[model samples]
Target: MAQREVIVGSRVGLHARPAALFVKTVSAQPVKMTIRKGDGAPVDARSILRVLALGAKHGDTVVLEADGEGAEEALDAVATVVAEDHDDPA
Candidate 1:
């Protein structure tokens, strides 16, 4: 298993569009993943509702953990998504 902690940098936090994008990214991974915030129980990273339910506001630190063959990569992708504010400037 691999785990990483990242802070939500988006001004609006992970709401609506960003939340959807985050779920999509995490769910796309083959590994099992979970996200936890502020000592809260971890939630499946693949579930949008569960992620949002964590109430991870802007600047809040979140812990991401994954297990399986591609766990590290999966966590990295999630970190990228959150760190980039789910924005792709392409």
Candidate 2:
């Protein structure tokens, strides 16, 4: 298993568009990934609903975990997505 803690930089947190973007990114990965807020139970990173249910706010630290082939790369990709401010113009 691979895991990493990252602070969410999205101005709107992991909701709506930001959540969708994160979920989409994770879903495309060839590994199972989960994300959790604080000490809460991890939720499927590929599910937009699950990710949005986290109610994570800007600057909130979250833990991303994954196992299986390419787990490290998957975790790294998702972690980067969560740490980015999607609200800002790309």
Candidate 3:
């Protein structure tokens, strides 16, 4: 398994649109991914509900983990997304 910690940059955190976008990105990967806040149990990264349930606010640090084929790439992609400020105008 590969894991990385990232600080969320979205103003609204991992909720609504931000969570949806993160889920969509992770769902496209072949590897299994999970995310957790602090010492909490990791939850499926591809599930918007699960990601949102983490209540990760802006500036909060979260851990992203993935395993299986392309796990490192998957983790890197998701971590980049999670660290981005999705709430900002594109």
The candidate with the higher lDDT, 1 or 3, is 3
lDDT by residue (1-90, candidate 1, tens digit) is 689999997667888778888999987899889999978898888898898888788899999998889889889988988876655445
Which 10-residue window of candidate 2 scores lowest in summed lDDT? 81-90
| Model 1 stretches astray by more than 4 angstroms | 86-90
lDDT of 3 by residue, 1-90 (tens): 789999998899988888998999999999888899989999988778788889999999999988788999988888888888867675
TM-score of every candidate:
0.90, 0.94, 0.93
Q: Write the per-residue lDDT of candidate 2 for residues 1-90, one digit (tens) a residue.
A: 789999999998888888999989998999888899999999888888788889999999999998888998888888888898878775
lDDT for residue 68 in candidate 2, whole number 0-100: 86
Candidate 3 lowest-lDDT run of ten: 81-90
The 0-to-1 C-alpha lDDT of every candidate, in the order given, reads 0.85, 0.90, 0.89
Candidate 1 TM-score over all chains jointly = 0.90
- Give the best candidate by lDDT: 2
